[model samples]
Target: MRQLLYQLIFFILLGIPDGRCLHMVNFFVPEFANRGDKVILECGFSVNDREEELYTVKWYKFDSRGKMSNFYTWTHSNQQPKKHRIEGVKVVMRESNQNFVTLKQMKIGSSGTYKCEVTSKRRNRNPKYFHPNENPPRFNVIEEEAKLQVVELAREPPEIQGGRGNYFYGDDLNLNCTSKPTYPPTTLTWFINDNRVGNSLIEDDLLYKDDDLYVTISFLRISVQPNLFRAGEIKVRCVAEITEEPIKASMLPDKKEFKLYQVKLPEAMKLSTQTIFDVPLFGDGCTNKLTKFILVIILFLNFMF
Candidate 1:
């Protein structure tokens, strides 16, 4: 019986192949996290079908300066690090699973490279005396390092309702500037001819609206002559601050900057006489009436001549 036991122990200590002993490990979280936001750090092993002996998983963090230090060390025992050692950080490990560790409530300080180390045991001739594996030993496990990134939350852009339309002189032009749903909402200002309009000038203004999230809208109106079109070079712009630039980069199939649309007068207009030609009617009722009126005026003048 003793000989049988000794043979079994010899095989476990020296028989297992060396090359397959320790597997590589790596960690990954979302590429970005806002400050004071929740982030998850996952630590896992590269080896598939690893023996149950691999239980201990250690997770550590490094500072922005690239200095690495221990943050979390977990084992089957219920003991955990003192609250003072790891502030604003929490970890949960599952023994029921293959020893997966999840770190949460991440802060800016939590940003850094994280590593997981696992240790397994090899049975010896003496079961209780079973020694920790030495050849493919405690130090022989895989190491995977993943970098954590922290970012600031982005502010929402203000909303611009309705677009610029043709208006004759002395016509009431009502313009509204509304703020869109934003994280850390902001106030809006209405501008006419590059001048800020006062609250008294606003025809209808409500500084705040009742909604789940914070929002505000301002409305302003002014009467100006059509010739002021030069001044009404209207551009409604909404600006927001974000950690990421909103532009999406796409490569054009061809290298040329093509003009997709060119503004040209209609073919019929080109054929019309130079004397105050009427605009050719296209679609809808209101436009047809205007075109007919202009045509009648042109015909009347030609008849009188």
Candidate 2:
């Protein structure tokens, strides 16, 4: 009898071939987390047979040697929080369907490998090593692990600055929009008179880190159109935004430069006039024959008188 018990123990401790469980479970974990936010790691399992067999969950962390150190456990509708845990880290079982562990107030040090394990509960009947509610018989075991990343938020908005120049029609227009160093990088979009710039235009964005923050600078380069530039400088606005952030980016003038030109009248388009053949002007040396004849008649009449 003792030899048979020893053989059973050897098979149980040594595990089956490949040491992998037959059941499968999916894990829902974020690739990264924002600082000061809640990070929820979920373990999802679907029982195709609709079996409601009692199950227990345990969450652990793997060391550099790939060894698991248990930090939290769930049994009998209760959970145990992790040891050496950061502030606000706890295990929460919502809907009694799956396992979920929430890490609160995440920081840079919170980055690490985390694992979730689930198993079916069974009664340990042996009297010599009998225990209640601890290390119950486990079957159909499944495990999943992931690496968590944390990032800080950047609160400042981006600044858009336009180059100083007396912009004229057909002149090259240049504008620069610089963003404050921030996490997750900032996005800068160029607009002219509320119209968005297209990808085919001369525009580009550059990013660099300043200390621990990320800064982005977007530049606009395009030849000014005649109708787009007018009496004054064109109003080109630089808008900056972060995709994950809830707040809107700082506003730059949404200005467009329209070109203006003077219109001239052609000679063919002027008013038409009629021609005059005998137009006379005073002090001209032209002979007045009628005036001489009248003067001779007047002298003869005077002599007869």
Candidate 3:
């Protein structure tokens, strides 16, 4: 009894008649689909009264700007389906009928609200078969609508740039994370030692590609501190995510590590002010051979003296 009451309330909410005449039974539309995929839209109905007969079925689409257009239609008298030419919508006539329509190679522009209208007619009780003055049949129409979103996913995980083999304390670390081209660019996040980093330490950018695709890039910068290291290393991770309706796609985080070493010097002997310089080492060339020769001569002269 409770289920029946719920059904009645649902019908009332949808403004559908509760009688056994002509009514919609079910409607199916995919909530999400990947780009370059084939999609099918279905509409089902039932007619219980013998006097009522199916009249016409039509499909319409609403774009992002809320513009409506009819894409397909089928009439019961002709028993043939008709397709209207529309950008980003390719109808497969061989696979389409009064009940369903097939879209081939759906693209990003295909993301929109789709509506199906079903119409039925009730025959006149006092119908004159050959009289031109008879009144037209009464038509009852029912419609249902749903939204679809088409998305393109990245082909590979995010790549990290500007990483070094090692790091020193009190140094500034700057890195960049980049994601491949995809529709509706991905969001990037940074982590250090399994802890999320604050937004102040990160910067984001997007590069537009052809066909409504984009590349996402994120930059991370932070000062190195002793507490940021664990087991003599610092771990960095970057995750790329795409959020869409009814589904979400994410790739495995890209990870990197930098070795950290402490300066081994006595506190008392360490200078209060020091200037560190990076000196280049000489290779095993003519200069090195000349130095070796001079060293040998000095040793011989010292022995003779």
lDDT of each: 0.46, 0.54, 0.73
1 against 2, candidate with superior lDDT: 2
If ranked by TM-score, best first, what sequence of candidates would result? 3, 1, 2
Question: Which prediction has the highest TM-score against the true structure?
Answer: 3
* Decoy 2 TM-score against native: 0.42
Off by over 4 Å in 3: 1-20, 124-134, 165-172, 223-226, 243-305
Off by over 4 Å in 2: 1-35, 40-57, 60-81, 84-100, 107-115, 119-121, 126-140, 143-157, 163-173, 180-184, 194-205, 208-213, 222-225, 230-233, 241-305
Models 1 onward score TM values of: 0.42, 0.42, 0.67
Q: What are the clash counts of all predictions, listed in order?
A: 0, 14, 0
Model 1 per-residue lDDT at 144: 64
lDDT comparison, 2 vs 3, better candidate: 3
Native-vs-model 1 lDDT? 0.46
